[model samples]
Target: MGENRIQQNEMSRRSFIVGAAAGTAGLAAAGLFSGCSAQPNTSTDNAEKTNSPTIPEEFTDGVYLTKAISMHGPINVKTVIADGAISEVTVLNNRESYVIGEAAINSMPQRILDSQCIDVDCVTGATLTSMAIQNAVSEAITLAGGDPGNFKGYQSPEPKEADVERECDVAIMGAGMAGLMAAWKLAENGKSVMVFEKMPYVGGCMPITSTAWNAQDTIIQKAWGTEQIFEAWSSVEAQLQSYREGRIEPDNPYYNPDMPFITPMFDAARDATDMMINIGVGFCPISDWPAPQLAPGAFSIGGKFCLDIVKNYLTYQLGVEIITEAPVTELVTNEGAVTGLVAKGADGTVYHIASKAVMLASGGYISNNELMEQYQPDELKFPLMGPPWATGDGLLLGQEAGAALETMDQGVTSHYSGAVSHAEISYIHYVCPGVVVNGSGARFVSENMEYKQALRVFKDQPTTDFYWVFDEVSRQGMVPSGNSYRLDYTFLLETGDATEAGNYQELAEKLNLPDLTATLDAVNECARNGAVDEFGNEKLRAMLLDGNMYAIKVTPTPYIAQGGLKVDPACHVQKEDGTPIAGLYAAGDVVGSVENRDGAMYRIGLTQAIAYGLIAGETMSAEL
Candidate 1:
């Protein structure tokens, strides 16, 4: 989802510029004028001559300023054009982090200047920043009366053939945390393992964010004195009830009949954590409510940390072979048994990996529009924010090999809790202590419902546009933890996504919510008197009054697919008749029913991936 988000952010920025230009045209027709027109000159004089191109006469000398949105926020650039050439390129302002965005900021502009073109290679690890600079420069060139498209500075790397190929005992698809862990385990057991990754680097979603996992009675949980929390919170009935909460229909076939299998899988998660720690993975403990047993029982390490340790151990210690930019195209099967698979390299070279066993840890199909429409057609209306490579490759391969899928309708949906304008950063405040209203300024779901449940209710809203209204006191208490605090409140305000007003009336006027003032009054009254509102939000009743108030509009975003190929508790791919597919195994997001126990509930994604990966690795190794 991290890589997908970065790409989406870039695409959105480009789209915004295009949309702005179209809007400017409409405004022009309406006799509206601005300081600068968005319409670009389409005259031949601004076009670049391919045979012998030179800087346009109009851009002979001047400084052009343009802004492009980076992964963090807007990046403003100053392009100095002098004597028919780019004399200097300077980044005037950006909110990018020094460690991630600095390299591109420092090196990309110089590359553009040296090459005398706007197109240049992006920094290896700083793709967003690099693209942002390129975009800013391109906008500057357009403003300078030059052909922005003709400034070809960034060049893609030449694709290379698969020069080496060999047989292995097991071939794993993907190099994500789950796939890497599976490779490490199998390789350590003296099995020759090969991993094929479609991406250039390891850690598909890892190295991009931090996530929590669920495990019971782990060393960390014991140390934190919360080892028994899971047993208390997670009973079989509770687990079943969790899955039944937010279904579109009561009779929907989303629930898994073999729901009890989750008990042992979570029980085995402690061993998975121990193995990860033994392999040098470090973790910090964090807490979440209601699911206390599931929350602090495991370690809270950033994806990058887990990826680094597992990748290093797999490559250097276990001697596992990993091929990046190699995507598995088909799974070879003989007499109903998996045998080998065909993969294509970046340069279109095909390599066949013959293996005794195959594991599919290739991730979910959230990024595949066709698959999303096929499985959960309703979800097609919502925006997806998962990795692009999660195109259901493993699921496709499994289906071709006679494996049945389960819980195809389930996926993770995240809420934009703060302000509609602050959608990008609203993910931070998952549980906003305030009243949530639809586009008509009327409350819908209870503000105190769990995040996932809230998402379900929000999705059903008439306009699908909502806001979180809170007082300054409640806002002060909204200090975020987890993978949510990338942007601060001030930044959100700067983006003009958040609305602040001295009183509810003013805020209502700004938000176009005619009934907002009355709604706010009622909510504030409930908060001041500790009275439960009609929504049964007793917890928020005491937290909403006093001081200035704010509103943040939010939209729904589906993060990861919760359904895929059906696998047994041992992580072996299973057919419809309740039999395992010989030599075929799957883990991670590729195995769908792992989370939606009864077809409704969701567990932590990383935990399910890791635990099942461990189980798959051990089971396959035992077969050897």
Candidate 2:
């Protein structure tokens, strides 16, 4: 952790501008890093795009440049084969996710070099990058006219176990937005903190960010007017109504009349913002936050990079120790009160960490398919976003320690994706508000409905498979730019995720949507006339063109889990009887809102975790 603290922070994706002409990866193509001539990455589809190129029967000793698609895009590796053996491997180009994929990028080359083996065990939690490197190596071998099978079966070194025993005033699980903020506060309050993260990286699920949070009286809000706070509360008033009517969870906000549940969250969000700003972090007012934004207000921490400011402060200035790839397995309690925890390091070593108190900030259950099937069955069909480690570790740990659950039935969905399966390169239709048709070939909801509302409409349909019908002119560009949200036609076309036809009717036939021809014609008519049609969508002005049309398969994916460990206002893990478990606490997506257990939901950026995390830290600091 000490050795990697600087490296991982330096390579965080939010502000991943590692300068130098010596830069590898995509920088070489742009001549920004390796000073090579810029070779534009094209979108030419190859019919025989197998996992690896054809393996040659004969040996040819030479450096082979080969590319394999990674989590985000292609990974180009420069392979040196000397005397029919792989001598060296260097990553040439890739926009692979940082933080999560940083370890695989930094270590795989050396590991391959050490063993002359292309099939190494993937770095845990970075399977996509690891797989890409292995495939790229295989392709390189094939290009060098060498049989890729010769490079198989890497014999890794024997595992060794070293159990570590450590003590801290407060031990936090998961070094994400919540855990980090809690650690920062605890350290500031003069507590020694130890943070254990399961992933090789520190950033949580939305490593890029969790979208903008609406704070009431932050400096940005001061500049943008704080009246939006009233609007935000008013927006949730309906949810409050559902709670009162016993339609949702039984968490009545009016239970404590003296302490109306909304204000503390707003104040905490504002203070959390100020906390970051005080540490040299900045903010930007997001006028165009995605739909269903906190009414009248939205903002983020100067983009995703601002989080590193707090991460660095906790690990360096505050001396909080963060052990990455150490998954906390169980809570070590004594006499019915929480005491500490037991964990396992990535190396198979045991970590018995003793602390005065524990905070479970180990993120959500989105990556856990079983939990999804149990809690949110309808969302089970959708693809999951974020790393595979978001399996509700905190929730499991809390349950083992006798904690109750809450909001197990609610969760939010991501943008309606046409082609997010390939390295998260999105389809332009989601943004363009293009012609969307369900499996039945009929337009369902308005294309421009609020993000989640539209997702529900599509997700509830008989089939999860949907399509985005667009013309050749609508085929957008590449995923070369680090922003994954931007459309990448090259990826879609090459992967055949987007199929083309001479016209709309042909495209419909190819996609097997029987009624798409009529749907497409009606949509075209509405767009050409700029008329609000059946769905009342005024934004459908971009009519579908006739020549060489494309239809990309589309569907909504699971964004994050809703249900988690139940906790009270003070961030304490609560029992079914509403009694707080001493020395036990939780924050982040591991628990929904601390104000109530009304629902598992889509909370805006940072504030959800930061608010409860700070409260947990301060409360623990005071109680202990």
Candidate 3:
């Protein structure tokens, strides 16, 4: 109920700016925005331009423009302007959505240019392009004898109110499940908690997310009947205990209070649905509930559950109010102690929400072009998939408040095809159902690895381009499962770039395999054997085959940056010098995850969020 009120009041902040900037991009040559150059003479002196490397005669013929473009990486570095001279620039080359980028470019004026460098920000996913255009404008100023750093057009908006007035026991930055869960527990303990969200809506990335889980019983015994489920769970529990004592330590990333300690997680494959159900979430219970277990130690869960509904239910239960469209502009501190946030509504009105403590759940920079380039430069080859509002707002806010960022090397990303299936929607899982073939048209990966491992397998492939081939039967038979849905053969042939073939031989021919006969024989043999059985074939085969055949050219699309604000086990945002920032806390996606762990998102991971957010809230409330 509070989500609606916040959305109404904060209407302007909801639209994400990410991915709205550019159309798609190709592998080679990127696109640049063409507009009136910022009156360069206002900022840089012509003398300064010549003092450096003189523009060659060849470079002088045209204006040099720079544009940041999006590849698979959240941000990519590409120069539309070559040799610091304007190469005739065109907006059409970028393959991302053109409307967002074109609109920003068209609005680029001397007045706007005067305001800030790349301050307008690009749409999410197309961050590179946005930065490129911003740089291009700045470069133009440098060329025209204006200081690139001196900009004057748009006056930055000021905060609506000072931060010293408001007060709360706990302040949460997001209204997502984790945040709500934390608030619920804290409020029950009598904490005055408030939530701040940049979007009008409160749910962070969950409304559209598909929810699936792995449980202790589901994997150990492939039984769907609820009756036998507990026994299977007990068995898993026993095995996990053994593993914990033998291999996993209490502090180990995978250690879960719910499961027995085990070295190999595969031994305890149980149904994740049981746990989610216990937590007040629902899932489809058909045999799919106890979805097939991946290889030993490989676990998975998949179900379609809209997050919007989840958010509504959670808000009602938590009794915590949310403020949406209120992008936090600053962190207020006194005497080197954290206090609260300086935020602005979409209407440009700002306010200070004082709090005993603050949790930065504002998400990451997968949508920030400038930050993306500063981090994963190599990922520039793929298009981005992130919420536009995910523009490092919380990260910057935390940093300004004396919080130090960490894990620049890690990001919350998984793999997808080169082309984005849907940029605006969050639930679209781009798993292609066809047989994966390497550059040599050879199948290299096990068909039923866990989604993370499956994605990594493809990522670790020698060639960037692979093909996903499936047939009509395969499509219809395949169901949308997991947080990200996989394509069944039918879906592949009907939509997307899947290659259509009449028969296995024809499909093999289309895929450019070395020999159609050999490929077909191998596939048939595997199918007959019920899918790579040596690796647990039936469950793998059930998810792999659907028929009549189609294929999609696949490449690695990295989403989610794994690293951000460094927080201790207690969820306290820390400084680079290793001191906790007073009155500041972090949770959910904005916080750094357990280090060096591949299975960070499983049960133990969410437990960490819940535990830390609880600690922060409790500590803040106690102080109050």
Candidate 4:
């Protein structure tokens, strides 16, 4: 970890990079966006790339080093030039998110070498990393006494044609939370399981994850010396009543008026803790909180890392088969039941995988703009917060396999989608005792309220910008319980995304908010008295009198476009007539979950991935 480690080596799950982080961080640390100023050589020199271009004789056979831009920072690369041809391009160091970064770094060099062109498409869902690699190579070319722009437009070598055929007891689409979950259970039950992910990486939207979510009497809980805690599904009855009143189609069969719970969701919610633990996704309980929700370690081992643990356990220990960068293009059906799928691999190999059961967990359609504009307005689309690979392939596959769609427009579960920076800095700082004031510098909603409700409250206001204002004491009190998933507030200050002032008047002038001084006094008055304020908020009980008062701007961005294929309690992809599609199952974001109004985080969204994944895997295991 101290040096630039190769990607093929065993990776450490711990947070912080040491070795490569030291390499080009000086240049990168100068400014957040200044590091990526080196532009691509777009001279269009031989745009057709037919004739082979000769290497400049000035270039000697030697190694060259250069730096390029990555998602978070800079990537140092070593380029090998031998025998008058650019040979190997090795990424010396970077600190990108593991999955997507791996795909681009591991493959792009060989891809360029094969094609022999500086002009090539970056890996899907990995634009920044891909550019970083190519740009590093371009710099190396310049350093080798040659025009870097000359590397483009060479006739590309043709890929060897190949095809692969396989048979498995279960074939799972997507290597995300739900698919990997299903693979774990199926493999454990001695079933031959194969998981295919279209993206070059394993984790789908999970790489952008935060919570460990809703576990009751699991091992982690036991170690915390806490008894089993039941998560109150307060919104279930309301959702059920709404469904009963109008939401359900006449043919929909999942609803039973006498049933106390939304059966599949409830059953899955209860098992989530044990299921995650069993899958080897590790975490700890929220401090002093009695709820079963876990706070997964952020920035390092939080969302995608948790899934990576599950993926590693599934593939290495449980013997689950996962093929990345291979997209299942179509479903092969026989007499109205899906029997298999056809996929194309990254190496131009066709994969015909035949299976007894197919589980569709390819995730939501947030990344697909055409599908997104259908359900949401351009202004409200929190598209960037979504994992770039969630292109709704599974939904399309389900539709092809005769599944009904519902709630496609309602999937933006959180009112504020995700991240101030869509790239590596999406994680917001901890939701602490703070005041989010509008442009006029007045607290609009209760600081402790959920984002879904917060956005609703703010919509009536006339301002576009919102600032999270808090004192030094309040920030320090909350830092120990920080989630790196939120953008670092300190980093925000360094990057000028936030402003800090020693006092209220200074802070007000810096942000051009004239009313901030009055706002703080009223808040301090309420805090000193230890009573509810006008907004009925007790969360603002912290006085803003500490050193270095801070204000970080926050925006409600686009995230997961929720609502998708409707499924029964059994995890079956339901048809319009409320009938099950034989040999087909769906889980995760592709299927809608039990509705909730508390602005629940992982409760409804992630629960579907866990619960339905478990149910579908178990059901398929029992059948086969």
Ranking by TM-score: 2, 1, 4, 3
Segments of candidate 4 deviating more than 4 angstroms: 1-95, 101-121, 132-158, 227-263, 266-281, 289-296, 299-309, 316-319, 378-383, 409-411, 414-432, 452-463, 474-488, 542-547, 596-604
The local distance difference test score of model 4 is: 0.64
Instruction: Please tell me which model should have the higher lDDT, number 1 or number 3.
Output: 1
Alpha carbon lDDT at 92, candidate 2? 77
Query: Over all chains combined, what TM-score does candidate 4 have?
Result: 0.74
Worst 10 residues of 4 by lDDT: 6-15
Residue by residue across 16-104, what tens digits does model 3's lDDT show?
21322222221222222233333445435663442333323332223333333233112222223344333333433332322233333
lDDT per residue for candidate 4 within 233-262, as digits (tens), equals 223333345445654444433444443224
- In each prediction, how many residue pairs overlap at the backbone (N, C-alpha, C within less than 3 A)? 20, 3, 91, 14
Which runs of model 3 end up more than 4 angstroms from their true locations? 1-165, 213-227, 230-319, 410-412, 415-434, 478-495, 515-517, 526-547, 595-619, 622-624
Give the worst 10-residue stretch by lDDT in candidate 1.
25-34
